[model samples]
Target: MHIKEGGITSPRIEPRFEQLESSLKPQIAPADASWKRATLTRQPRFNNVVARNWRGELPLWVSYWVIGFIGNLLIGIIPVAVDGTLSGHGYDPRILLITLAGGWLAIAAVSVWQGVGVWRSADARIIARKDLGRAAPWAILAKLAVFVGLVRLIALAVNIGAPQMTELSRMAFFDDPDISPYALRIMRNGTELEISGGFKFGLNEDLVRLLRAAPKVRIVHLDSTGGRIGEAVTVYNTIQERKLITYVSHQCMSACTVAFVGGQQRWLYSRAQLGFHAPTFPGISAGELADATEEQREIFSAVGIDRSFVDKALSTPNNSIWLPPEDELLRSRVITNVSDGSNFAASGFGANLPRDTLAAQLKKSLAALSDLERVAPDEFNSLVDDFLEGYQKGQTEAHLLAQGRQRFLRIISTNLPLADDPTLIDFGKLMIDQYTFLNQRDPSLCYQYAAKGELDPFLLSPTLREREAALDQRVLQTAAKRPTIPAQILQSLWGKVISAVTLRVGRDNAHMILGTKVSPAQYGSYCEATIAFYQEIIRLREPEAAELMRQVLAPK
Candidate 1:
């Protein structure tokens, strides 16, 4: 099969097949083999490098999916659920919402950083460059969209589970009976102790301990809806003993009011509220109720509170709280100061009135009363004895007299008869004057004054006085037939007269008496003299005759 081009015959045509077969087999050069070997060596190593790079970024990708999406979703949902569950349990929802928003932002920021890091990696950049025309923008956006959608789905799941989660958490955390609702703090450098929440049994002990630990603590800031009458009473006694100040910046209600009244100096913020209601002993027997009523009356009475305030508190049903008006609070002396968290000391009652100044003022008041000589000798003497006793006990004469006057008025008012007759009004005025003289010759009692059509002894006309005398005879005659009438009905009628007289005297001469320049001891003596005079007059008149005279003063 070999053809010779020259004249020489080809050597061995039979063996040409071998040479042809050899030529047909492929032949490799050294350079070409070297190039193939080099390519094979580089390809696998390049793949390995790419795989390592991806592995390095795997954690970031995992984080984006788990923490960014799932974790964030849970964070947002947890608070929402918790807040929902605690809706009425005193948690603020806005706090939860803020927490959720913060969590989401933190997660989103981390996810974006990680995703960008992956996109900027060497392998990723190479791939992106190669796919620039085919899948650059849309593919990246689609991936991001998928991630975002997953995150949204997680959020949706959280929302769906929120209600149930909230309920579960609430039951777990809030409904536990062992947890106390009260919060106590020693604040303002331990000069103030704040008590918040319901008054529990241990509160009194806690307060005592706090007071002992920080003897400098002069202020007890009360914010309570009130609780346990017995505990409140204990607190009140402690406060009174320590002569501590009580302050209400928010709410003081029910038994809390009792504590507030016990303060040596009581203060209330403009926005603060003091609520009162009749004492309640749920499921108690009638006997218990009666006892409770008496106890409450005694508490207010001890504080020099008027019958009106007591009546208002007692009339309010247990379930309802009576929030007295600011004016009422001021007038009742329940809150001696209304402050705005500044200058409390300066604004407080008697804060500006030095003891010496008060004593001087009281003396002047007594001197004026002594000049009148209107009170009976015996009553005046008794008043003097009481004043001296109080003074010896380190109580200021003015304070003693004020307390006595307030107590006397309260007693008379509580027992006063409800009558519309002018003669009764006149008689009431005379009785009030006599009582005022007996307590402390408040010169105001000598002045004529009546409110709401009631008789004011100080303001009574001679004709009215005569008529009152006539009514007294009639009352005595009636009382002879029914002895109980003198103690119950006639006594009340006499009490009304006493109340009217004292109210007028106090109203007209309060400033004069309280701010007088006389010495306290002298003022006390005058008060005693006036009281003694009134006492003698009553003794001379006899109870039935006095009561009869009171009735005679009532208008027909």
Candidate 2:
């Protein structure tokens, strides 16, 4: 090496990679306070490079949606690929190998390019959004997460630690030679989560395990006849913290429904039964019972879930435990989607519709009435108030039909959020519009929304272009991992009363029901009955009916 300063010039030779590392041998900082020191720090993957790189370039909302797409493609690859293979529709091994390798190379390329820019910049040090002291830290952490996500995904594929395919059937006992709480695969949709064990579990059990594991996992695979309350509490805490999807593709039972409450997104299935019964127990001292209730209350409070839901879950056991009907679960945040025999499972939590249909119909119906101006909002209100005035009332049909246009006016004014936009009187309308032409044309959304309609590919597509973001330089320097895909498909068709979105419908008012999964005409009729019933319940302030109604609302 030679130096060239100002006027002096000399010959020079570049140092090789080995020479540089060997000579610099820059020692990492010594252990700080308590333990051994390290050259680099560790962090949650989300807070790493990608998140640190958040900027003014993209809107926050856009970033949220885009991140999900990117995460699905990059992070969800292993499961998607595995699912495809098992489903008998995946690419051949050679091509698949290339596909994964290419993904790595692509991510590397992005990191390299972004790293160069960062290296050349004035504020080069990165850090994650949550732990930002410098840009350098953000870059390092984000890159690491992407890298970790990829590597973890690949390793999962390599570990097919399940029993032989010939080992079990639907009625087979739990006898798989291999077993693991970690799911072998969770599909692109929410239908199934295949653990390393050949013996299948229900939605609640898997969810509880995933939640307890915390930051290590983002999603859960739940399969259960629906087990204990304590486990449900654990699962609920996890879902609420991570804002994950809660599922019930196979069978979601009693205590399982407790954890289901924590889910921000809830999903269910066709032939997918959700059952609940009162909490079963042997005799206990009064003091023990009080202590148990307090314990239960604490669990719910910690998870930010409603204890009233616990009351409802416990209400189902009159003669014996019962699964609350899907309709009943609608009252709480627990379930997002419900379907009949529909095999779509990769959907996180609920197989929510892009839009609501009944709401739209109600809006349109109201509009037609508004045009006629047959009666004003006040007259309709008077009629509704009178109907609700009953501990029991007259034949609603003649009174309702006679009310005519006023009936719609009352429903729209009271139940809908459409302040100025009469056209938007029903939120369900928006959800319904989301249905693709295929879903709309499907004859079964009425038989049950849960059992029919196709899911959009965007929701299920596995593509990881976002992992190659400029800040993921660490990913450029490292490896990849894969995950197990759930056996359930990402696309779904729901049966009547199974489409949970109906619960959020305008239904002429706020109290949603489980009945929208029925046919459209029936949906309207059911909504009428539900609203009427609730109207009375709300108006009369009936505390007496609360306990009984809770049981009736329980899943059967």
TM-score of each: 0.31, 0.26
Q: Candidate 1's error at 135, in angstroms?
A: 99
Stretches of candidate 1 off by over 4 Å are 1-180, 344-556
Per-residue error for 253 in candidate 2, Å, reads 1.2
Runs in model 2 deviating more than 4 A are 1-185, 189-218, 280-283, 297-310, 339-556
**lDDT (C-alpha, whole model) for all candidates:** 0.52, 0.37
Q: Which candidate is the best by TM-score?
A: 1
Candidate 1 weakest ten by summed lDDT: 1-10
Kindly provide the TM-score of model 2 when superposed on the true structure, using C-alpha atoms: 0.26
Top model number, lDDT: 1
Candidate 1 residue 113 C-alpha distance from true site, Å: 86
